[model samples]
Target: MTLSTDNALVVPHPLGLDYHISLQTPYCILCRYAVRPGEIIAAVFGHWGSPSYLAYTLGFSFPTVAQFEYGATVYEKSRSTSYPWLFCRRSDCYNCATLHDTSIYHIDCFHIISKNTASKRPSLRDIWTIASWTESLPKTRYQAPPDITLGAVADETLIDDHESILARVCSIPQELRDIIAQRCPESPAWRLVSALSRWRIFQPLLDPDIEIKGFSFDDIKSWCRRDGMVAGSGGSGKIRIQLDDLGVSRLDYVNDSPALPTAASRSQNAWFVVEEVSEMQEARIETKGPFMRIHKLPSFHLWDTPVPPDPALTRWNREITGNLRILRIRSIALKDITGLTVFCQHGAVRWIYPHHEETFPGPYSYPCDNSPSMAQLVPSAIESSSVIAIFFPLAKGEKISSVWVRRCEPYDDSIPDTLAVITTRGRFQLFGKYLCPTRPEVHFQQLSGNNTATHLLFQDVDFPFQRVSYFAAVSASVNNTGISPLAPSQLAQSRGFSWSSSFCYVSIVGLENVELIWLFRRQVPEGTPERDRLCLGMMLLYEDGTLAAAGNCRQGPDIDVQVIMLPGSIHYKISHKAGGVAVECATLDGGRDAILGDEEGWQSIDMHSRSEMRFWFDDSRTIWITSPST
Candidate 1:
């Protein structure tokens, strides 16, 4: 890789008129955990970074190109792990075990910190809050490159050869690879070479073989509206991703987070349904990396057409076929999702509750770009402010029984916004947005465990496009359910708190709920006049159906006298009395009253560790039971 006199410019400013040297892309590393925003950062760095720090983070001035844009100057000679088409391929190693964020680095690595060069450079949620505090040990991943023959692709040749992966998958032809091989027929060929080098589809105006040859057959039957065809649409059950297709310094990465979340289908998959209404595009992390822009509101503009159709593929082809016939009469699959919402209309809409898919690649959208904005969330100037509101309505056969997310914050360390979830028969889905409704915040930072959510974790940092600071939800289960031998004497026995007396404390934080669908008790109305009156009030439907209170109940949700409906996989034990309100009991399954429901008495843990959940209040208000937290 030593051939890089380091000019890495792709569009590094100065009237970027056909400038060159981005050796067909690789270095997107400014540490966006799952990088892929703007391109250009080539890094074959032998003499080590600093071409004026890529001209002050790519601003301009490299003037000297009498027409140049060839290729193959990324110094070849065989370095392994083939780095293929990236706009998404960063598997976090900020808690470095060998510096692994292939979005390249070295302007003083963590952005200049020679023991402290005027501080401030953390953000990527401050290095994922110290890499979510302590977690490097996974080491032993082949290792090798401490310089045996002193590498840099010692001579370079493995661009995953075969005429360079067939000149990068025949520039997306074979009719856009049979329309992206019928929308990912069991992906891998890094999902068709990272969706044809991430829709840069050899750019001749986003080439579908030179400006879409009218993709025909209803754009490959409206982007493979499911049927059956999984065996690797590229043939021979494709796998190919050994790494280094053209530099990601020596690959092997993955401590987990190889990347691929949204992009169900699209070869113009009929913009699915486009009335397109979303606008906030403030943007930061800079250098062409965050354009969630898609301004095209008032559509079809009162047609007076004589002969005009292709306004970017026939103005959404008849309203995406009337929204795919209203998504086939709302037949919503993916188990009809049920709930998951994220407020802020003109620039954030985490939809998914029957409104399942038409596009969902949040945070400055990147299910591999081409955006005409079909609602890819994350933009907030405080319009709706409802952190993780709804997806509420669900009755017909009602079945999402449970799934969770609540990280809350309006005080303390600040910037967490708020979130929450529940179901089986409606009336609880209140994670956020329903026309701007959000007013309860007694502190709830984490919970997730009533199943059905293979994955949905938006911990804040939107790629290198940072600053959205909050939105947390984590759920994964069907087997392994450990922890709760009453967790380390219930977080080291503070279940009897006194933190040096003086009273007035409240921390109802259910950090990692193991399950509990509903229970918003607010007692003392028995025979009225307050029966023996220590009159406790309560609220807590966590594990997603966030309904706070418990210490600050304040007679709301219509005085919740008692709404007990538990069983999100059982294991409840909440005894209360934290300085006032008074909640005495919420028992089930475990064993300070029988909790360990088996699985070898559970204690497995290791979910990438690092967990801490707080909730302390005394006057005998000690509710205790645990499922997650290290």
Candidate 2:
């Protein structure tokens, strides 16, 4: 496309974006063009080869006040205690070209710093700075941070593409690697960021709908402390994890919480709960004697007197050369970790004691007797849990260039439940727990946008840990742009929801009220002659939807809602004129709130009781409340 203004380089890195910009108003570094939410077809200049090659958007840090190791809580680079901008380049590309004089680490390892001479204006990366929306510009596509956040669907509908993936699935070994490397629009987030730094871009965006700074669980623990008392890091007593009042109780538990039995209702979920849900109803942690658990390694023609410098391990170590990432996983249940084995791309190594003799299934062991869980025991995969083990091996010669992990709790969440072990044939062999528990079969509850209801989706609880993304919501939201994209995972091994390219706007009607009327998805094509555009109708009907909160980022004041507590009276549609769907009349009677728009181009809506439309939203699809069974 032709540019009216100079555009930033739209280059495609073999790797994805640097840090998927967490800030909302994502703009082009060069032109400051504000990318509209759900805008798919935009482009930037290339960093290297082509004009519009697809690449991930990189991130830069915003400079702010400082706290030095010498115990001074003050702004940095300041002249005296005031006149902060007395020295240094005063410009707005953020610390794109500066260095943090305070850090011991090299500039590359630290967040770029701004000098005392910088302007007082907030940087574009500032969370408080809401980005200004631009008028409709020439349609174009460029890789931006929003694009990386799964904020919008990258390409068009990919529903029918996965079936075609069978070709690569059964392709010759030589071709399989090529197939995996080729960019498949079906799951660009995973493929592009599979081995890259911005892998968080691939994580399934979960909910709360707020801006989350790069922080660990420990950080949250400190912030949530009401008394503002932090344990002394240098103290020598029992480590007091100062995380209390989170409702994570240890009162109720399974009688035998340590054994998985046949023909019993044992949900392997208790092991993964990091929230209030802490009960694992049916499934129990499989343990033996004083030993908590034992894992059997791949019994090949390998290792009898297994000790250090084993032949298989040394050989595999020699053959393996490239970036290596290890993700550690631990259960909420503490267990004594003993000897184990690590299977690499070229060979496998058994790490056992020198005097310990081993055979076919002899391997690592864990023994511990403690139960402190964060989630309540739910009998199904109705909610998100961490008790999963899988590996995503890179291409034959490709080492995992980047890996993304989350900080759960116990700090040991650092442990990875799954590993992408390299095998002799350079394949990813999962070396952790079995994908499914030893029970006959598992029936997981579906996520039907309702927390209290239950819908049994009787199928194998297949954890799409590798291909699917997972994340939680934020504190607040405006347009729900940052809401984690949701898909009906059980209905399909759904990678994500698909959408057609169009001019779409999302209006979250309620701010703090979690009642009916969640979002309004309006698509208006440009240049559609106003006279010809009859009733650009926007229908948003909600029923029995008790979502916690709502937000909208678009700039339109057409809607004015007032709430007065009355049975079945939750949402009220005053008016909306932005889309030519001006409300000609609105009335509340009998329990139904009816809205009638102008005749030339009208929009109609009804907001009422079970009549209150309870709906959930993703970037792509809309889920209406039809029945609790859904």
Give the winner by TM-score: 1
Q: Which stretches of candidate 2 lie over 4 Å from their true place?
A: 1-561, 564-587, 590-630
* Model 2: per-residue Cα lDDT over 125-152, one tens digit each: 2211111001000101111111222212
Kindly state the number of residue pairs that clash in model 2.
63
Q: Please give the CA lDDT of all the candidate structures.
A: 0.25, 0.20
For lDDT, the strongest prediction is: 1
Stretches of candidate 1 exceeding 4 Å from the true structure = 1-40, 43-338, 341-393, 397-413, 419-426, 432-461, 464-630
All candidates: TM-score: 0.25, 0.20
- Evaluate model 2: give its lDDT: 0.20
Clashes of each: 35, 63
Residue lDDT tens for model 1, 78-149:
222252222212222111122121123223223222222233323332222222111111111111111111
